[model samples]
Target: MGVVNVTPDSFSDGGHWFDTTAAIKHGLGLEAEGADLVDVGGESTRPGASRVDEAEELRRVIPVVRGLASEGVTVSVDTMRARVAEQAVAVGAALVNDVSGGLADPDMVPVVAAAGVPFVVMHWRGFSESMNSRAVYGDVVTEVVEELRARMEAVIDGGVSPEKLVIDPGLGFAKNGVQDLALLAGLPRLGELGRPLLVAASRKRFLGHVLAGEGTPPPPARERDAATAAVSALSAHAGAWAVRVHAVRPTADAVRVARAVEGAA
Candidate 1:
């Protein structure tokens, strides 16, 4: 999966594709680079970011989703709004990648259930503004896995088909580097959730911290693509069903190598 953030404040590549035409072209570019699916998100979920009004979000997202879908792209609408998800699906979004895992919006599960599209339920603590404060966990892996399981059950109970659900650990949403690394190491435990795993560790803060040694500043977001590709390779090797990334080609190459190793195994 390739990421197309259509907001002005996404952590990475925000303003780059804020334009409808540019966003569509970028999605096609990702497809050409070997992305199986392209994810379009309007809201900026970066830490400490404030929520954009629903109208603005719709304005930023729908046109791009429609444009990409028109060109035969398998698009996923990355949103927490039920109305947005519903409209995007109607406009040809094949999946709903809800960062809040249906928690932020009351109608999100119902909308996804009604649409009958695949849903990416991500592990989340709260809204971006207050999320970091809620990152506390006894054992990050155990807690995340348990929480994700509960969410999956809730979503299933809410009328969504079990087979249509996928799970994401949400590497940087509310987690610090230690916790994020723990989750990566614990991918096998996450796989026990009985659903496909979507690893979305592209250009996240944790990777930046890892790349930057202690007492040093990390590189800019765009410069983290190689690190993201490394995480993608590791995640795929560890049985991740897919990886959402900003740079598709390098990660795609790494994933192909991992898949080849898996085939050999």
Candidate 2:
């Protein structure tokens, strides 16, 4: 999956695509760079980020989603709102990538079920504004897996078919560097949940920290693409179904190489 943030404050490449034309171009570029799907989000869910009202989000995203779909691109609406998901699907979005995993909006599951589109249920503790405070965990990987399982059950009970579900461990959401590393290392445990996994560690802070060494300032988001690609290679080797990324080419190449190596093995 490729990310196209239509908001102005996403941690990475936010305002770059805030314009509908720019966003559509970026989405098309991602597809050309071998992204299987493009995920378009209107809200900025970065740490300490405030929420955008539904109306503003709709205004920012609908045009971009519609334009990309019209160009025959496979589009996923990255929204937690049932209404936005519904509208995006109507405009030809093939999937719903809800970061909240149906927690933020009560109507999300039913809407997804009715549309019969694939839904990405991420491990989420709270909204972005307060999520950092909720990062405490006994065993981060185990807790994330258990939480995701509970979310899966809830969505299934709400009428979404289990087969239509994909699980994301949510790398930076409510996770510190150590917890993030633990989750990545524990991908097999997460896979035991018996669902496809989506690894979205593209240009995240954890990767930056690793690249920076101790007591050094982490590199900026765009400069972390190489590290992101490295994670993509590892994640694909470990059996991730997809890696959501901002810079699609390197990850696209990395996953292919990983697949080739695995095939040879």
Candidate 3:
């Protein structure tokens, strides 16, 4: 999966793909870069990010999804709003990538269940505005795994088939640097949730922190491509079902290489 944020405040690529034409171009470019699917978001869920109205979110996303679908691209709508998910699916989104994981909107579970397409549920606490305060965890990995398991049960009870769901560890959301590292180290426990795990650590702040090491300034987003590829390989080896990345071609290449080596072994 590739990341395409059509918002002006996405932490990394804000304002880069806010225009429809530019967003479409970026989506197409991701396709050309070997993305199996492109995950597009109209709202920025970066820490402390403000919410956008429903109409604006729909306006920013639907057209891009339609255009990408027209080109036979697999499109996923990265939204927590049920209304946006319904409209985007109607237009051509094949997946609902909800970072809020059904917590933000009361109607999201039912809408996703009715759609019957793949739903990517990220582990989240409250809305973006307050999630940072919810990051406290006794053991980050175990706690995240437990939280995701609870979410899975809720989603199943809400009528979404377990088979149609995928889980995301939600790398930077509601996590401190130490917590993020612990989660990565314990990803296998997350995989035990009986759902495909989507690790979205590409160009994330945690990766920058890891690379920074000794108080050096973190690498910029564009410069994190190689680091992202390394994380892709790590996640895949740790049994991740997919990785969401900004630079798809390199990560795809890394995944292919890892798979090839695994097969040969």
Candidate 4:
């Protein structure tokens, strides 16, 4: 999956694709670069980010989704709002990639269950505003697996079909650098949950943290693409269903190499 964050304050691109046209072009470019699907989100979910009003989210997202879908590109709406998911589906979104995993909105599960589209049930501790405070865990990997297991159950109980679910570890959402690294190392445990895993280690803080190697400022977001591609390679080799990333070309190439290696193995 390729990322197209259509918000002015997204940590990755910081509004590079905020305009509807720019977002559509970026999505198409991802498709051209070999992305299996393009994920378009309007709200910025980085740590300390606040929610944009529902109207603003819809206005930012719908047109881009519509534009991409019209161009025959598969599109996923990365939103937590039921109304936005519903409207995006109406306008041509093929999947609902909710970061909240249906926890943010009561209407979200029903909307997705009723729409019958695939739902990405991410491991979310809380809303982005307070999520950093909720990263506490006894054993980060085990806790994340257990939490995601319960969320999968809850989503199923809410009437979504079992066959229509995907799971994400939600790197950097509530996790610190060490916790995120532990989760990556624990991918097999997460995969044991028995749903396809979506690894979103794009230009996240942890990558910058590792690249900085202490006593230094982390590189800017765009500068982390090579690191992101490295993670993409490992994640793919470890059985991730997809890696959601901003720089599609390098990851696309990286995953292809991983697949070739897997095939040889």
Ranking of candidates on TM-score, top first: 2, 4, 1, 3
lDDT of 4 at 205: 93
lDDT of 2: 0.94
Q: What is the C-alpha lDDT of each candidate?
A: 0.94, 0.94, 0.91, 0.94
Predicted candidate 2 versus true structure: per-residue lDDT over 1-265, tens digit per residue: 9999998899988799999999999999999999999999999989999998999999999999999999999999999999999999999999999999999999999999999999999999999989999999999998999999999999999999999999999999999998999999999999999999999999999999999998999999999999999999999878899999999999988888888888899
Q: What is the lDDT of residue 105 in candidate 2?
A: 96
Minimum summed lDDT over a 10-residue window in model 2 is located at: 253-262
Instruction: Please give the lDDT score at residue 14 for candidate 3.
Output: 93
Stretches of candidate 4 off by over 4 Å are none
| Candidate that beats the other on lDDT, 1 or 2, i.e. the better one | 2
Evaluate residue 108 in candidate 3 and report its C-alpha lDDT on the 0 to 100 scale. Answer: 98
Name the best candidate (by lDDT): 2
lDDT of 4 by residue, 31-149 (tens): 99999999999999999999999999999999999999999999999999999999999999999999989999999999999999999999998987899999899999999999999
**Per-structure clash totals for the candidates:** 0, 0, 0, 0
What TM-score number comes out for model 1? 0.98
Residue 192, candidate 2: Cα error in Å is 0.5
